[model samples]
Target chain A: MMLNLFHLTVLSFISSLKEETLPVAEFVNKSVKWITEKFSWFFDPIKNDFGDKLEDFADMLAEIPPSIVIVLVVLIAFFITGKKFGLATFSLVGLLFIYNQQLWEELMLTFTLVLVASLISVIVGIPVGILMSKSNLAENIIKPILDFMQTMPAFVYLIPAVAFFGIGMVPGVFASFIFATPPVVRFTNLGIRQVSKELVEASDAFGTTGSQKLFKVELPMAKTTIMAGVNQTVMLSLSMVVIASMIGAPGLGREVLSALQRANAGTGFVAGLGIVILAIIIDRITQNLNKESA
Target chain B: MPVIKVNNLSKIFGKKTKEAQKLLDEGLKKEEILEKTGCTVGVNRASFEVEEGEVFVIMGLSGSGKSTLVRLLNRLIEPTEGDVEIDNENLAKMNKDDLRKVRREKMSMVFQKFALFPFKTVLENTEFGLEVQGINKEERSKKAKEALELVGLGSFIEQYPSQLSGGMQQRVGLARALANDPEVLLMDEAFSALDPLIRKDMQDELLDLQEKMQKTIIFITHDLDEALRIGDRIALMKDGSIVQIGSPEEILINPANDYVEKFVEDVDRSKVLTAENIMKRPETVDIDKHGPRVALERIREQGLSSIYVVDRSRNLKGYVTADDVSDAKKQEKKDLKEILRTDMPTVEKDTSIQEIFDIIHDASVPVAVVEDGKLRGIIVRGAVIAALANGNEVNGDDA
Candidate 1:
């Protein structure tokens, strides 16, 4: 926001001369293009190998019989929600409804996408969170970057993501990753810091090494909060599906995007309904998982 | 020998510690040091030794640095100056690994808030210290279970800390520290969070554990009664510096300063007072050396209701009431031991005044303070009441 205001002042002064504007957009575009060119080595494997593996995982899930998948999901939901079966019933009916609508393939793809993005977010975010908690300088440096990642339009990440990975699920995963990561990082940091000072002292008093302390005390204590963040990340990734569809990412999001272009409200609503079913099932399951851990 | 020794330790909680420490050494007070150098002295030139198998309690009011001082012993809060030697190894000079070795094998702390890991079961919490030392799973679990049972929580091993009461949780905390079998146990207000009745029980339990384990313990508390009840020696602190370090009786009887005086002024002395303090040097006649007539004359001369009769070695045979002795004398009895009655209540010298009060109230004769069957002194009802009333032992020793 501060950058925007600075650019705005500069733009206003520059605009007094006719059809001229600040070169901030050009600068960002050139910088990203330069990064893409210079760091092709870094971006290529992620685009190719990781993207293909994700696709295969999604395909493998899609190939499973709908009845079997529904039963398994329902069983997990039943047990995880403490066996009363409210969420289990929801999962049973919701999966059946999506199957009945012939949107099973799209649902699997969206589930894979959300799960993969959230997994990536966790793997990267937790350590970053730990670093931020451990050092004041790291916290100060990363907090503003997190603010930018969270507040910037999700659509803006697509350009560079597509530039690096081309149009596919990979860039979609990339955009969802950037958008969904902050909460995990933030909540992880909050969770660790929120551990009572006495608890920290108690662990230290026992002479636990840094890693031992983190895993045995801090991480386990922070699990619930981190799970809360992960749950948010999953839901946020689901929210990004439609936006992700604009970059040729497959799933129910594609259905939603195509339905929008063709002005097919009935199909769009059905696809939107598919996304909602997946979201509610995933959300309840993750939340119940968190409760179980707690 | 001292198990742990802290020499001229200071912890200044700011960037300008060198200047603050210098100011502190120059005898500037905590506030003055803070004002001059923008550094708060958390512990100021504190030094004390904890003897092996001793319960050394550091007592102070809130913000008086007792807590800070305890942490400094374990290097939990780094001292800005000086050294803490645990078994001749300097804690401040050690690397991370060596310091950890000291912490894991030499000492462990029990936190005031009962800082059991909420996610861990009681067994896991207790297992923590041993687990950190890379003990085998079987051994660590066995030790942890034993430690839990030592604190009387054997059945609750599978239960999480939240499921336990505050007292039980503190037990788990104590068990955790004990599981490591460290020579020194640092308890930072370990029982201050419990209800009064439970606190008393825990204090008794700790005393029991201390007796059994014989671990050198550094206990921190703001409560003087708790300190007096548990501490073998007490260090009285004021504003980040120790004012006095002495036994509970010494601190109570002769406070080092007005602060120490004020701190202990409101204490209920009945708790610290023992039979030894109030016991009078009773008049007694040796049965082997004196007859019933001598016992009767002595009782009459002392204007006493009774006189205790003893053997030649002063082993209490029993007390003889004046009437009985006179009756014996009238009968021309030669042995005072024949008329002596053994029904008078006998108590140990270390027995607290409260216990003595109950024992002496129903007894007709003075309560005999006996040690190994030998009479040490006698606690009469008058002397017991005088000690309670004056909050100090009277001139009972004068006799």
Candidate 2:
């Protein structure tokens, strides 16, 4: 009862603002409508005609048996992270296959999206992290933006992304990018900042220039934390794939959403299985990369 | 000409605020802010000159600003007021490019932590400074290898800093600094972090390196023993100002005040005092090395407290006191090392007098300063007592 009262109070407050602040509220409302209309034409094609293209992108990837790729990836994990990790890699894949709905094509699209997003995340995230760590002003300005980007609801991110680029793999890629980037930036900053003060001073004492200090001391010390952030980014990006399908994004998210709409439990279960497999594959690869670096 | 000169240098931190920044920018004195806000004076109106190829030490306790003073010389921290002239160039006003160039070409430093890069192997850490100067990677590798060899880390080039002991890590740190071949090396308590035995070895290694490299070093440490052993001249600092600057001998013999005297009071003089403190003129030494009974007869007849021993080259060998001869009287044949207590109160010729007292206290024997393992003269208890009292050479014979 108290919670309902509190919700009522908040809703009343918002409703009162519309009356008391008409012009300002109207301005916000019209601006949003105008933006939606201006961009509506561009999005019409993705809504109307892009389904076959996305389906084919999904299909092309789906033809490869996940078990083969899983085995290959497990071997690679062993090569990179050693035998102890390879066993975990194989076991995790087996669990995903048994538990998931097992639609291979949809899973492949999710896997490709995660791989591309994680790559972009690292490339962009590290430099920003280095810059923020080096400059106090940059850190102060960038921190709040990163906080907002990470904490806001995932669906809310889709709204702006759709408004800008419309609903398709492009918008899906972009939404996942926004959702996944915060951990990388935050961790990169943390890793660089946490480097030992004595070590940094020692480098300075040895007459190392600013650039050498960064490359030789700061970056290397920051590697463990930065890799952790990369792992989080991969996980976060994969999480967004299923959510992106709500707005006509192809692959496992679409299959799951469509199956749910029709109440077809078998279709939904199989698609969910594929998504799980894709998630496991990505998680293993990135986790192994981190261990190898370590 | 002096290789380095510092004049009227001071560093004032946090002098400006929102209300008073304009006044400071317009050349207000720091004292004027005493009524409003506060400021920390890191380096007071300090002045000193270091001659070429001298190991000039700045000794101070933590927060005394000796470290800050050295940093000021390199413009690592810019001075609020004054000039640092290194090889005749004013460092305070150097542009960034020039300052960077100067640091690259003329000054290297070793930190207490032995700041080896944990990410890179020892060889790579050594090469990093040279790499900053835009040297090619291959050249850097070769130079770094040579530097590692210099510091005796040649076999461990592939090892990361984590794999090495503290002493070995410091060696890599030293190698990195040496790789630059800077004319002036600044060490801020560089060996203070090592264990006692390692500290001693590092000190000896530093002295050997100084002998070979001929690099002028400005070493900072709170350990007076280290200062006495390694410094050609030492500047003792208290607070932000120098208390005394002199050779170790002058400091031990004539400490400027109660502060310097108290610092010297506990130093083991045996390690610090040299043969020069104890040796007499060679012609004045009337005893032979192994004549034995005759020298004992002379001691009884003359009522002497101690007798000096010298080699054919007129260098100090050791000294035998009246007590040692009497003790040796019962034995038929006595070698000098056995008769002399073997552990004689001895010092290097360059040891300070304060250190002499330290050695005297430890060995409980009369002091002798040695040159090439032979005696110069004997500074018996009376000689040191008289020197302490009269502040110079004593005129009285041993009682």
Candidate 3:
């Protein structure tokens, strides 16, 4: 009976992979048609009102010469991460000016959303990690769930998120969170588990209570690994931003996706550059913060 | 009076009675507990005591329950059946809170591995014990600084544990224990992990510390030399039970059992013996410094080849002999170095008897004398033989 079940499971898994490939091809096929329909909807009265409001805001931002603010932020980041990363950052931002794309506001919006999602992931992931460490049953049950969440594609995560929240910024946030949370949890667990047994015993010998050990010994030693986890989470969130834009998540992701649909390579390329610039800044800044803390 | 005592601390493992009995029936030693139960028994029905300020050493081979027995004292591991009384308090029945209070206030342990917190700075690791006692950060930091000074690592306070060498890290561990200033210090092979030279340095450091702050110490070691060097009373354990517990002198001259005798038989007993054991009594006449005939008569009267010379002030001058006086007469002017065997080894009055044989083997001399700078009296191999023959009964004349 076990052998028959194993054979059946293998056949089903192979079939699922073949079945999932069909939707990917179909998605590319209908791209042009979808873009035209999307363009017409943008001109509709209600949609036009929203687009005009956003356009006006972008125009106001354009008048301020964002290069000044970008420079200031870049300098502050440089102070945190050091000069090598700072100069690399300035060059990436300079590319945005060279491309002369009108999607700078969209880039900022995407950056904000990813930052928010990753911060929340870290805050929530740590407690779950501590709980898993404390209880064997919890660890056992969570292990398979965590493994599944990590192994599944971030795109697959979008379906359930969209089904629950529907298409908007909220669903985009939900998707980004699901995409980014696994590393935070995995690294936190590893960090806590890696603390020295001798240190643990020393603290115990000194009559350190449970909370004291967790705070004084366990948390401090786990800090480096947890920060590394945060690094991974940020990178993962950046990867999900463009995918999130399909659900009306306003950002460089949406700008790039729309440009791609119309085969506007110049526009798409510029938006893609903006995304890369944002990813690099966020990655460098958080990584430096972690290094300092460690 | 016994400040701490233990009784019948047997720890059996596995649920099967037949297996335990079968192993016992096969004449397995208590150390064979691991092979039978598949679980290690750290302490086996062991018992001993420490006086108010005694430096008691529990010496044994690895896995002989020395470390476990020390842990059992502080309730680090709960004893299976024994009652451990610490200063009239029943530790076996204390609740967790009370036990914590006891550890925080009365006792502290130094680990063999020097369990300093790797992430914390040396200052922070040293202050950890005080922090656990709920002292505020500023106050504990002050105390930790003081402790670092005590162990002579004051300048390395801000450095992390990884920055320090093994000896420095263990000094921090010792400072951590000392920071709390508990009444009882339990050292679980704390210096065993350092390099041999560093181990010697740490031992000297501990001896200096002990002189200033005489806390009751329960030190554990597998090294016999370390036991003899530091222990006020040494307990030699085999299988699980203590074969003997006494001063290093008593154990060397008269071991309580054949096992202890076999353990110390190959050891150099001269290094462990004190000068008092080898010194001649006041009734024994000293050989005259200038009379050749009289010195020879005194040597023959004492049935010894040599006799010690001393001034009327009772200060040792040097050892003299009938041959020394005759040689002095043959030569008009005598060289003091040739007349006297100033090369003879001497030891402190309280040195262990084992050191005597050790010095004699190395020196290949007939006798070594007990002295205070100059020779007081001679202790020939005959004295040691007489003491060994009489065993512990050699209480008066021999040693």
Best by lDDT: 1
lDDT of each: 0.90, 0.76, 0.74
Could you say which candidate leads in DockQ?
A: 1
Q: TM-scores across all candidates?
A: 0.87, 0.78, 0.75
TM-score for chain B of each model, two decimals: 0.88, 0.73, 0.76
lDDT of 3 by residue, B247-352 (tens): 9888876888878877777665556556565555632233334444555566777676566555455555556555776667566533433466545566656666
All DockQ scores: 0.71, 0.33, 0.49
lDDT of candidate 3 over A1-294, digit per residue (tens): 999999999999998887756676577446644653565553343244543544455446555566765767667676776655755567456545643666666765676667767877888888888878777898898888888877787777676455444465656767777778888887888888888877777777888888998999998989999899889998988888889988777788898899989999988888888888777677777888898887
Query: How does model 1 do on interface RMSD, in angstroms?
Result: 0.6
Model 1 CAPRI quality: medium
Give the higher-DockQ candidate: 1 or 2.
1
The residue-by-residue lDDT of candidate 2 on A200-281, one tens digit each, is 7666655567787788778888988999999999899888887888765777788888988999998888777666666765
Tens-digit lDDT track of model 1 for A1-294: 999999999999777866777699999999999999999999999999999998999999999988899999999998988888798888888889999999999898998899999899889998999998888899999999999999999989899999999988999999999999999899999999998899889889999999999999999989999999889988898899999999999999999999999999999999999998889989988998999988
Candidate 1 residue runs with Cα over 4 Å from true position: A1-22, B279-348, B355-386, B392-399
Off by over 4 Å in 2: A1-19, A22-60, A63-68, A85-102, A205-210, A262-270, B15-36, B275-378, B384-399
The prediction achieving the highest TM-score against the true structure is 1
Worst 10 residues of 1 chain B by lDDT: B390-399
